[model samples]
Target: MSNSSTGEIRIFDVNPALDRAALAEQFSRNRRIQIRDVLTDESARNLHGILARETPWGLAWHAAEDGPHNIRREDLATLSQDERVAIARKLDTAMRGTDYGFTYAQYPMLDAYLKKWSPGSPQDAVLELINDQPFLDLIREVSGIAELVKADAQATLYGPGHFLAQHDDSHVAEGWRLAYVLNLCNTDWRPEWGGYLNFYREDGDIEQGFRPRFNALNLFAVPQRHAVSYVPPFAPPERLAITGWFRDR
Candidate 1:
């Protein structure tokens, strides 16, 4: 199978490349690359729609009073989509800065975290995707990492007032080689709305940042300090994405 999108559930198609030299150079020198339209438009739309309604979210509570307070849902089940989103947004707003605060394990920010899905899990279309060979091939082609054997995927929902503090995805036990976020927001989303993916230098200065570009895949080598900035109250209710890592195992 070519790993292209099916009519029933559209998967993403890699962007057509006339010249891959730039992509290879970016990944090689910077250890990161952000590709637009990683998913087909229809596929992105369908996936976002499914996430908006189908995900069964639960509140993610961190250890400290100023710790993580976003809602998460790991168990997929049948439910009303609109109703769930409403509930998620309501809770997200209620917890912001009042009793709940942003205090990172080592950094600072507020954001929701979703339960991750492993391969072969039921009703998990996201995992069904990372397992596709074409997608793996695409990763290899761009990242220049030939030995990458597996991938992990999870759904992340960032509602208004939610954010992720700066942290490096580096635990020897986890074995994550590269981190990626498949953004599922509207294309017209504005920078002033917040929820940007910010990259930092070792000195703690921001080297660069990325808006939640719809249908885009932002991939970076593991252990880089980065964060998702807070989504302000005026922004849309939900910021959705499928985030995870490509592993060497």
Candidate 2:
């Protein structure tokens, strides 16, 4: 897609052109929808590469008992190989399922990464493109959420052994109306390799599961129970995506 650069920020012109009425109806009916080919081919491929290689990532671990904790990159670098493995084992055991606990890794926040990585990084431009008014307007049209005015975004990398447990993205204080994921993996990404996004019913049964599909945007109404499955050790590729939420101002 063609885009214009203003100062250091690039304004992307790509639009998935989803069926707004159908998408709104689906969200009203089921509270979630997944739309494929969310971006032009070249733009998606370029973003996939930039996010995979350029962003600075941080590890986050969570336990049912302890909540969430972050392992800074410097701290991780100081750990010995065995120490790191031991930590991984602990996280793995804790995050096996809802009955246990969960942990995961994420790249820097789009806003924070922009400020820290350098002036005018491409990652910042991508973030700007997605957060621009046109994109937010599209989300509003599709989801039928007139109140959604702002968005928060971050890149995520799920490598072997990372996972997230089931939890509703409900923080009334945060005004998060809908959660979104822009999957950047190739369509060839395998379901068996794990890293699937799953939504659960009240009884804890899986209502839906989505494999990572390139150029796809998945959106779900807030306060719905969902989780990301663990990335298996044998998975051939890392699961990468940009995820966040649209919020009421």
Strongest candidate by TM-score: 2
Give the local distance difference test score of model 1: 0.66
Model 2: per-residue Cα lDDT at residue 249: 71
Query: What C-alpha lDDT values do all the predictions have?
Result: 0.66, 0.75
Q: Tell me the spans in candidate 2 whose CA falls farther than 4 Å from its real position.
A: 1-12, 72-74, 82-86, 96-100, 111-117
Worst 10 residues of 1 by lDDT: 103-112
Once superposed on the true structure, which residue ranges of model 1 sit more than 4 Å away at CA? 1-7, 17-19, 63-123
Q: For residue 205, what is the lDDT in candidate 1? A: 95
Best by lDDT: 2
lDDT of 2 by residue, 60-123 (tens): 7766565466665666678799976776676656656445466556755654654675556766
Clashing residue pairs found in predicted model 1: 53-81, 58-72, 110-163, 111-163
Considering summed lDDT, which 10 consecutive residues are worst modelled in model 2?
1-10
List the pairs of residues colliding in candidate 2.
none
